[model samples]
Target: MQPIRVLLADDHPLFRSGLKNVLQADPAFNIIGEASRGDEALLLARGCKPDLVIMDVSMPVMDGIECTRQLKEHDPSIKVLMLSTYSDDAYWQESMEAGASGYVLKRAVDTELIIAIRAVMEGERYIYPTLLGGFHKPGGKAAADELQEEVLSPREQEVLLLIALGHTQQEIAEQLAVSIKTVDSYKTRIREKLNLTKRSDMVRYALKHNIISDKTV
Candidate 1:
């Protein structure tokens, strides 16, 4: 059988190296390329034409979400499996929306990652098992019903995620290219919608709802 051509995309050199080593141990996988940023990943993907890309959700220059979207547009057949430190359901949903074939948490065991890769390679969608507590599948109706109740705007969801990730308001604003006041407004709206009274409450809510994993807090 032909080895699976794989591309690694992550900002952290050590993480990429570790992933490369892990995949190299499996003869079924071939490490075709490595990229340190989203744009680099895109360029390499076009050049190498890897069968799959294991990409970090957060990256400099362009985020993995936008990169995955562009990759799918350029070549729908190339699969993308998002790897992230966050176990946030919002990130998982956004990744799917951006055309990722699978979502796996960074903290997942090597076996789980391999399972996800194989599942995606076989043309099946995969979501980390821990993140699917109340749902039968990646985008199940239970999740949709919960989303209806929250009704957070995309920007608000972004803000809430950053907050749960322990980013200060200023950092969130900087990352989103918005002012601190705008971040605060988003926070206020999120709190009001969820009836949260404190930052800790928001963090708790994020964890309880799988908006973020416990490790993130």
Candidate 2:
């Protein structure tokens, strides 16, 4: 059988390197290309036409969930397996809604990623379902389920996260490669949708809703 053609997208160079080494050691997989951000991943996927893309859930320019949505919209045949350090149910639910074939935490890569890859290649949705054991749990399960009421666009969530992280609008514009005006537009939409204005309110909303955890993405 032909090796499974694979592309990898992760912001951390050390982690990406480690993953490369892992896949390279196995003959069942073929390393095609690597990307450090979601947008770059899309470009590489289009060019290399990899059968599967190992995507990081968080990334600059474009988050992996948004990328996966766009990829599947562009070509439903391409497979995307989200890899993240987060074990939150909201994250996994959002990823599956965005058309990801599977979701796996970075911590579980050693034991479950290959299994996830195999499952996804065989047309199965895979999620390790790690329980959220480290959260503050302000409102418990209902807070997470409230995600069904309203949803933030992936870009809006990205901007909101940057805002919660104390990044200036100018900094966010620079990182997203858009004008400050565009960044403002995204912020306005986010604020309007969530009815959150203060940075602290945004942070609390993100936490209570499980859009973000205390851990770094």
Candidate 3:
């Protein structure tokens, strides 16, 4: 039996340290590395290639949402579990859009996190029980077409779509049959057209404009 390798990423050092101890207490999880910022999380995640990332939704220099998007782009196989204090459905919505496997509220029972991690590793999506009533599932092609008309080109729209789904340029390139440069170009154009000021801002716009469904974005 292979042990599950886990990486802890959060801006709060004490929280991460405490979480590390909590996870290490469980024999099934192995703490492989720790990161204090979104950028560091991306770098460590890429290098360590951990099986699971337990991350915070809020962080500096990059938020967990964008970091998770980049991570999934780098390695779609890696599972991400978002640990957050926010009850805002937007976080839940954005996290799912960013390809996070699970969303666990920090105040939930300790076992909830465990369950979420295990479920994600087993190829399942876990959401906090309290949030289920409000999770909005988007309509079909009509909704997609509305998002498509947001001043982005066909390719740029595709890139924005993938970004909403938590794919990075490299991942989007392979998925769209384009080069990384091509994906970047599309992203640049999309950002400019959308008037997005930051990578995170692009995600927020995708969320605000309903470019991606609430459940996914």
Best by lDDT: 1
The parts of candidate 2 lying over 4 Å away from their true place are 131-217
lDDT of 2 by residue, 1-217 (tens): 9999999999999999999999999999999999999999988898899999999999999999999999889889999999999787788879989999888889978866775786689676665633323323468756634432234555667788898888999999999887797688667656655556788988887776677787833
TM-score of 2: 0.61
Query: Which whole-number lDDT from 0 to 100 does residue 216 have in model 2?
Result: 38
Off by over 4 Å in 1: 134-217
Give a tens-digit lDDT track for model 1, residues 126-182.
666556543334567655546433455455566888987879888998898877876
Best by TM-score: 1
lDDT of each: 0.82, 0.80, 0.77
Summing lDDT over every window of 10 consecutive residues in candidate 1, give the lowest-scoring window. Answer: 129-138
Instruction: Quote the lDDT for 31 in model 3.
Output: 92
Query: What value does the lDDT take at residue 7 in candidate 1?
Result: 94
Candidate 3 per-residue lDDT over residues 27-82, each given as its tens digit: 89899999989999999999989999998999999999999999999899999999
